[model samples]
Target chain A: MFRTILLLILLVALSYGFWLSPDFKEISAGVAIFLFGMFSLEEGFKSFSGGTLERVLQKSTDKTYKSIGFGILSTTIMQSSSLVSVLTISFLGAGLIGLGQGIGIIFGANIGTTTGAWLVAGLGLKVNIASYAMPMLVFGVILIFQKQKSIKGIGYILAGLGFLFLGIAYMKSGFEAFKASIDLASFAVVGLKGLFIFTGIGIFATVVMQSSHATLVLIITALSSGQISYENALALAIGANIGTTIAAIIGAMGSNIVGKQLAGAHLIFNGITGLIAISSISYLMMGVDYISIYLGIADDDYSLKLALFHTIFNLIGVIVMIPFISKMVVFLEYILKDKVTSNRGFDSAKYLNDSVLELSSTAISSILKETKHLYDNVFEIIAHGINTKRQNIISDKSIDETIKDKYSKEKVDIDEFYNHKIKGIYGEIIEFSTKAQSTTISNEDIERLYSLKLACRGMVEAVKDTKHLQKNLIKYSNSTNRHIQKEYNLIRQGIAELLRSIYIISRTKEEDVVLLLLSKSKVNMEKYDILSNGTLDRLIRADSISDEMATSLMNDSSYAYDISKNLISTAEVIFGDVENLGMAMSKEDIDLILDKKDN
Target chain B: MGIKKFIKRAKEILGLEDEKKESKKKSLKRLLKKLIKRKREICTMLKDKKSKELQEELDIVSLQIKKGKKILHELYKSN
Candidate 1:
């Protein structure tokens, strides 16, 4: 609704401008074309981020200075701070990077954006760039029609540059024509009053345009053409700095608390930077003059001086605020505490949110992390349900000896356990997956999501199977009949052992070792089957156990096998890196393992 | 006629006389035929498949057909 209102107002303003002057229409069209180029440029950069960008970002953000360098380099190359900020927020939302790391990136982006001002001041005004734009557009349009991804990406990059140059050319001519009719510099206020007013105009224009680069270009072009004074342009630059935080704030709106906190940091940093610039304008102007004189800049070279002033003040802000990063993180955390859901006993999702749906990678990441959280809880519940400690199952102890110990009947309540631990997260994952599938996700990603949901279901089913097996397990653990008790103990031992192996596999980084261990477990699974081993038949034939006891043992053993199977299957999907192993325990491989065991 | 008799009569009408002469081979051939037919049906259904359920079913049936064909090939070699 807010966007719609803003659009309507913009439409009204543009319509009125078109009626007043044809020159205004040309300028407005130039701005529109320029913004479209920004969009295309962002798209072109995004096409290359399949894994390399994410990997580079993850590896580079380990330290404060490193993160800042990464931020500067990425924004300089991408040439769009808004894109950088959104990517940083999405990474923060997915818990891929720390809040401090995110803030460092934002600060570096501030300095990185000064490069754009230099480019426009140093070259854009002096060069006849439109002559270069024609061939670029022609070649770009030709390449855009090709089928490959990289070709299309390069096409967008070339076209975006072409449009940017053309837009600048058009805007320059239109502004020159407008100046002939009426000088905009005549309306410029002087001193402190003029500073605040122009700063406000700068903020409004950046917020409306959502690009500080665009605003800087406009200011530089106007300053060069003598339509705006250098001092007022300085104030406008400060406002543009503050206004760019709106993109970060808007990006964080659909994110979790961490994303919002990073946005808060952005606003505070930019807000403080703008205030400092406005207050220390006179002092900074003296410094700029000294630097300008030292660099041999002429008195009439306001555009170059403005670019230097922009760089210096941003450097000052980073220097001033760098020491207080830890404190800022603490303050933001204290203010933006995670909201606890009232009366809910279990923890809910911290990362999954509707805003992340804008990017497929972030959405998949958030869900993957949430599913990990679910699995952690499920692992604990499974341990407890089996009447063994979680540590013991994952430890080096023999499970055959471990199941000999008796557990209290009071602990394993499947219904209450399901309600508290598994059901809510399971439902949320299924719902989230269904919603994700509706988006324009790739088929491979959709299949991955489906497999994840199935893994969750497998976990829940394993718990249910354990619930059925638990009664017989506890009952026969203390049974007087040695044969019946021994059979039940074998069943318990088998499941506990399977859980231990899976637990071990889950913790190990060696994929080859894990794959071999999983295949061996499938081979060993057949050994525990009482029917295949003839244990039940041998005991009944000898009349060592009652028929009722034998029947109970048979049924309980099947449940045990099922619980292990489902749990192993779930583990394979969730943690085992099944794809690298070429499908989880194919039947042929299992048969081969069986044959080896037999041999 | 009863359903079993009707099936037998249909087989006879379809000129499956050689199948009756060797019951073991006949059963193996019938299974192979059934599996191949199911595979063809799955392939057709999968062309414009919309649901994951259908995809999963197709995968299972395809696996089953592959295994069945392997077994049928082994039986032919033995004969």
Candidate 2:
């Protein structure tokens, strides 16, 4: 409600300003266009993330230096530190990268943003950029209409650059006309008082723009137009750096705990760097001038000097804060503890955070990971439901011993386990998958997503089947009739063997190994089907078991068969695609293998 | 020549006529190579162990190699 009122007030103020001065309206339009260009730029960069960007992000960032380097390179190429920070947060929320690595990337992004200032100061101010914007816009719009993803990505980039150039040109012209009417330079205060006031203004401007790079570009254009003094511009740069953390903070609001910790790290890092730059302002100016002279910049070139100062101070900030990253991670983790860790039981989706929903690749990766997490829970429930201990199954113990070692003396509440462990996470996976597929993801990713959703359903079905099989499993295993007891025990051993094989498959990365184990499990499953082989009929005809026992065995065996089939199918979708290798053989092949088996 | 005809001719000459088929053929060849190596290993292991598991593995590997080779053949034949 308050936001509505504030928005209404802002609209009225904008209207008033537009009415009072055409120059004000023009400048406002320039800022709006610039912000829109940034959005387009982010979108353009995101289009490429389905391939090299996402792959590089997952493969790189093993070391702190590599993480920082990735941050700098990505931001410099993309020309937006805000985009880099948001990606880092998404990566963290997806559990793709660690907190220390995320902080390094944020640090590198600060330095990377300095390249934007250099681009604007060194080239944007001198060139007639608006002329270039026209042809770029034409070509960009044409490519944007193309069906190919790469071409569309290129279109967005070119169009974004055009809009940015046009915005800068508009602002420059507006400032020039405004200078003739009113001397904005006369309003500049001196000493620390002016520093504090202008710094506050810079913070407010960047907070409104949500982009320090934009704010810096504005400062450079204003300075080049002789509308703002050099000292005040320096202070504004510091304020812009500090205020940019708000973007990371906002990005982290919907993300998981690691994302929040990274945001806190971003805030604290930028805050200290801002304070350092402000306190050492005179020394930084001297350093910038010395470097400027050495590099042959003119005495009148305050804008380049400002860019130099921005780069130098951020470099210094990274150097000074590098040692503190480990300490800061400890501090942030202490402060922003993951609530999921403290609350035990009733498992929720750990990797399905909103931040990862930004990209289809990240979304697919997270859901795939969350499905494995669901599989973990299903393994436990199925192991316990059949009265076999989970550890014994995963162990290298014999099947007879694994079946002999029961999970509990009392029957586990299968319904409660289903509700507590499986249902909530399964519902979340479905909801998140639907949300993901609704986005502008490609058809291929959508197909992969559909498969992941099916895997989740299969896992849940397996657990429900285990629930149905549990009652008779408990009753018949302890019966006086040795024949019925032996059959029930064999059912337990069958499931135990399937669970162990799946556990091994889930852990191994070798496709051949996965294929071999899957084949073995299928053969074993067929071997244990007593009803299909007439073992149950043999027992009844020979008067070895009663009629009631036969009925129970028939029903229980079917349930057990379903349980094995569902879990095996689930494992195929989850663990079978080892590096996209065909780990799961076709049903025709499996049947052929079983038929040729020399028993 | 017209632009579309020129492009289509260029793609055929460059062996980029159909990207999916090209990649599938490449991956199938790679898998077939691995399966052949695996079949050889299983054959050796069977000579040493005389185990049922080794024999089953040899059969599966041989079948997979046959399947991959057939797919690769069809991919070329259609082209």
Candidate 3:
């Protein structure tokens, strides 16, 4: 409701301003074009983020300094701090980076955004930049029409740069023209009162624009044209810094708790930085003048001076806040805690979110993580449904001993467990996967996603199979018939062994060990089917068990076989090498290895 | 060189020709090396205290090593 009212007010104001002055219309159009350019630029950059950018982000954000450096470097290259913030939140949601690391990146991005001021005041105002805009737009549009992903990405980038240059030229001319008609400098207030008012204006403009970079560019252009006072521009720059956190806060809205914590950190950091800047404005301006003189910027060059001031103050903010990131993390955790949903209510997907859906690699990474989360629940559910404890399976105990450790005397409520733990997440993974498939990802990623979907299906199937096998497992494990009891015990042993193997495979870093365990589990899975091995036939022929016992044993054995097969295949899909693209081993490969061994 | 031969050579240079086959061969070689090492370790363990599980593992590793080697050889031969 508030957003709608604001939008209507903005439209009325814009229309009224356009009627009052054509120059106002031009400046507004320039800002519009500039914002559109920023959007295009971010879109262009995101196209390549499918892999290379993702890899760099993962490798670079291991430490605080490195995370900050990554934040600065990526924002500088993409020229959009908002994009970096969104990506950081996505990474947090996917469990890719920690809160401290995220804080570092946000700090770096603050410093990074100052480079835009330097670019605008130094080159954009000086050069005949509109001349460059023409060819770039032409080439960019041409490339955008191409079929290849990279080409289209390049197209958007080129067109984005072109539009930005064109927008700047329009804004500069519009301001210069508006100066002749009505002196905006006359409207400028002075001293602390002026500082507070302009700072408020800066925050409001940036909040509405949603890009501090855009708001900063506007302040710089207006300052260069003498339409705004130098002190007011400085206040606006400080306000823009504070307003930028609004982007992070908005990005955090749909993200997980970690993302929200990082956004809170961004807000608190920037707010404190803004307060420090406003309180010490005189000292900062003197320092800026001293540095500007040392750097040979003229006394009248308020625009360049503003850029220097922007960089220095943000650097000070980062320096001041870096030491407190940990404490801030604890503070944010205190105030805005994650809702404790795990203990009560239907368990939902943790990693799947709108932010991660921005990049293909992130989307896939989060989906894979969510699948593992689902599998964790599956492991516990299947373990307990079989009357075997999860702790025993994960322990370094022998399968014989592990299978003997019962989860409970009574059968576990599999239906209730499934509804509580598995169903909601399974539905979400499928829905998110379908949504992700429509994005600009490669067919290979889509195939991998399909395989992940299959893995989820298999996990669900395994749980259902456990439910079917549970009744008989409980009944026969305690039966007086020794043969039936022994067979049921063997079924438990086979499942326990497979579960142990999968757990090992998921944890170990060694590819060789993973392969060996997967292969070993494949071999062991064959042992679950007594019907195939003729053990069932011998038991029947020897009259060791009754016909009813034999039938029950046969059906339960089939379910055991299915449960083992599904879980093994799920492990292979989720934990397997990327080179395989989730391609499971064929039965022929297993049989060939087995047949040669038998020979 | 002719266009086809030039293109083929370029693909080879780029490591794009029969990419799946090359990757499979590489995977097989890696698996075989590991399998051979595991088999040796199993054999060494068997000498001190023989166990049915260890024996079965030795057989499985040996069979995999042999099969991987054969497949890898076929991949090379086809190339």
Tens digit per residue, CA lDDT, model 3, A1-599: 98799899999999999999999999888899899899989988887776667778889989999999998998888899888987887787777887888889999998998999999999999998999999999988987887667667878999999999998888889999999999999999999999999999998899988889989989999999999999999999999888878866876777777778988988998999999999999999999999998999999999999999999999999999999988987788799886765557678898887777778888999999999999999999998987888999999888888877787888888999999999999999999999999887987789889989999999999999999999999999989999999999999988888888889989988766787788778877774579887999999999999999999999999999999999988988888662272223457756765665567
Model 1 Cα displacement at A210 (Å)? 2.0
Instruction: Give the number of the best model, judged by lDDT.
Output: 3
What tens-digit string does per-residue lDDT give for candidate 2 at A408-494? 888899899998899999999999999998877988798888888888888888888888888888898998989999999989988
The CA lDDT of each predicted structure is 0.77, 0.84, 0.86
TM-score for chain B of each model, two decimals: 0.55, 0.79, 0.79
Better of 2 and 3 by DockQ: 2
What are the per-model DockQ values?
Answer: 0.01, 0.28, 0.25
Candidate 2 chain A has its poorest 10 consecutive residues by lDDT at: A577-586
Better lDDT candidate (1, 3):
3
Q: Which lDDT tens digits does candidate 1 get at residues A171-217?
A: 77778888887798998889999999999999989888888888888
Clashing pairs in 2: none
Each candidate's chain A: what TM-score? 0.93, 0.95, 0.95
Separate clash counts for every candidate:
0, 0, 0
Off by over 4 Å in 2: A339-345, A540-543, A578-583, B1-37, B68-79
Interface RMSD for all numbered candidates: 18.5, 3.5, 5.0
